[model samples]
Each structure stands twice: as C-alpha cells, then as structure tokens.
Target: MAYVFLAVAIVSEVLATVSLKLSEGFSRLGPSVLVCVGYAVAFVMLSQALVRGLGVSLAYGTWSAAGVALVALIGAGFLGERLSGIQIGGIVLVIGGVLALELGAEHGP
Candidate 1:
C-alpha cells in the first residue's frame, strides 16, 4: 500500500539522518556507509509511495515532520543532546500541521 511505502520512507529517512549525525562528518566508516545506503533506500521508497497515489503534499509533509521529530528525539534520548521547551513546542506544532494536512485531504470537497 501507499501508506506502507510512506511509512518505510519516513523510518528510513529518520534512520539515515540519525546515522548522519553518528557519521562524525564521514570520518566514521560504518555509520557513514549507513547514511548513504539509508538515504538511497528512503528516496526509492518515497518514489514508490508517490507512484502509488499518495498525494505529494500529504506525503512530503508527513515525511518531513516525522523525520524532524524522530531525529530530534533520538538526539536527545541517545546522543546527549538537549531540546529547549520552545523546540519541543515547535515539534508538536509541526506534527500537528501534518495531521491537519492529512485530515484536510481526507475530507476535501
């Protein structure tokens, strides 16, 4: 299903972004390779989702919003990073906006 592909794309992108941080400016070999491979697979999956009739706006909004939120959480929880209250609020807003987009699409005229 299109949604399945989109979910894969989102998770792949999130992992790739986290791998990017772990790559240490590409100085580390394993994570660096993961970064490249993850992103490549992410793009391919995203294209499959689009080709399967997932709307561009909805797909991209969900993908980007989820990616940002997941990456931030991973950074904070595992990478010793901190997020200010405002940043947390921003993440909530981004996710909310994506939800709005999806709901709007579902109930469109």
Candidate 2:
C-alpha cells in the first residue's frame, strides 16, 4: 500500500538524517554509506507513494514532521539529548499542520 511505502520513506529519511550526524562531515565510512543508501531508498519509496495517488506536499510534509519527532525521541533516548516543553509543542504543531494540509487539500485539480 501507499501508506506502507510512505511510512518506509519517512523512517528511512529520518534514519538517513540521523546517520548524517554520525557521518562526521563525510569522514566516516560506515555511517556515510548508511546515509547515502537510506536517503536513496527513501526517495525511491516516496516516488512509489506518489505514483500511488498521495499528494507530494502531503506526503513530504507528513514525512518531514514525523521524521523530526522520531529523530527527537531517538536523540533524547539514545544520544542523551535534551528536549524542552517548547520543542515538544513545536513538534506537535508540525504534526498537526501536516494532518491539516492532507485533510484540506482538494482531491481533484
């Protein structure tokens, strides 16, 4: 389903972004390779979802919002990064905005 592909796209993009930090300015081989491969797979899955009738804005917005949330959680839990209430609220707003965009978009152009 397109939803599955979209989910994969989101998760891969998030993983790719996090791995980017671990890539150490492109000096690290393993994480750099992971960054490249994960992004490539993400884009491919996104393209598949687009072909399956999801709007690009909707798909990308949701993907980006969810990616931020997941990355934040991963950072806090695994990397010992800290998050303030404001940051959490902002992330929540991003998610709500994505949902609004999807629900409000015109079905036909």
Candidate 3:
C-alpha cells in the first residue's frame, strides 16, 4: 500500500538523519555507511509511494513533516540536543499543516 511505503520512507529518513549526526562529518565508518543506505531506502520507498497514486503534495508534506519531528525528538532524547519551546512549536505547526493538507485533499477542491 502507498501508506505503507510512506511509513517506511519516513522511518528510513529519520534513521538516515540520525546516522548523519552520528557520522561526525563522515569521519565515522559504520554510521556513515548507514547514512547512505538509509537515505537510499527512504527515497526508494518514497518514490514507490508516489508511483502508487499518492499525491506529491501530500506525500512530500507528510514525509518532511514527520522526518523533521522524529529527528528533532530523537536528537533531543538521545543525542544530548536541546529543543527550545519555539522549535517545538514550529514542529507542531509543520505537523498541523501536513494534517490540513491531507484533510483538504480528502474534501476535494
């Protein structure tokens, strides 16, 4: 299903981003390799979702919003990164915008 592909894409993207941080400017071998592979998987799954009839706006919006939120949370929780109140609010707005896009699509033009 398109949704399944999208979900995989989101997760893969998040993992890739996290691996990117852990890669230390590509100085680290394992995480660096993971970064490359994860992003490859993410994009492949995203394209598959698009090919399966997911609208571009909806799919990209969801993918980007989810990736941003998840990466932020993971960074804060596991990577000793901090999130200001403003940044958290921004993430909420991004997610809300994606939800609106999805709902608006369902209602048609």
Better of 2 and 3 by lDDT: 3
State the lDDT of candidate 2 residue by residue for 2-93, as single tens digits. 98999999989988988998999989999999899999999999999999988899888978898999999998888789999999999999
Cα displacement (angstroms), candidate 2, residue 10, comes to 1.0
Kindly indicate the candidate among 1 and 3 with the higher lDDT. 3
What are the models' TM-scores? Answer: 0.94, 0.91, 0.96
Looking at model 1, the pairs that clash are none
Which model, 1 or 2, shows the larger lDDT? 1
Number of the candidate with higher TM-score, 2 or 3: 3
Q: Quick one: ranking by TM-score, best first?
A: 3, 1, 2
Q: What is the lDDT of residue 94 in candidate 2?
A: 96
lDDT, candidates in the order shown: 0.94, 0.91, 0.97
Q: Which sections of candidate 1 miss by over 4 Å? A: none
| Per-residue C-alpha lDDT of model 1 across residues 28-71, encoded as one tens digit per residue | 99999989999998999999999999989988998999899999
Ranking by lDDT: 3, 1, 2
- Each prediction's total of clashing residue pairs, residues at least 3 apart in sequence or on different chains, is 0, 0, 0
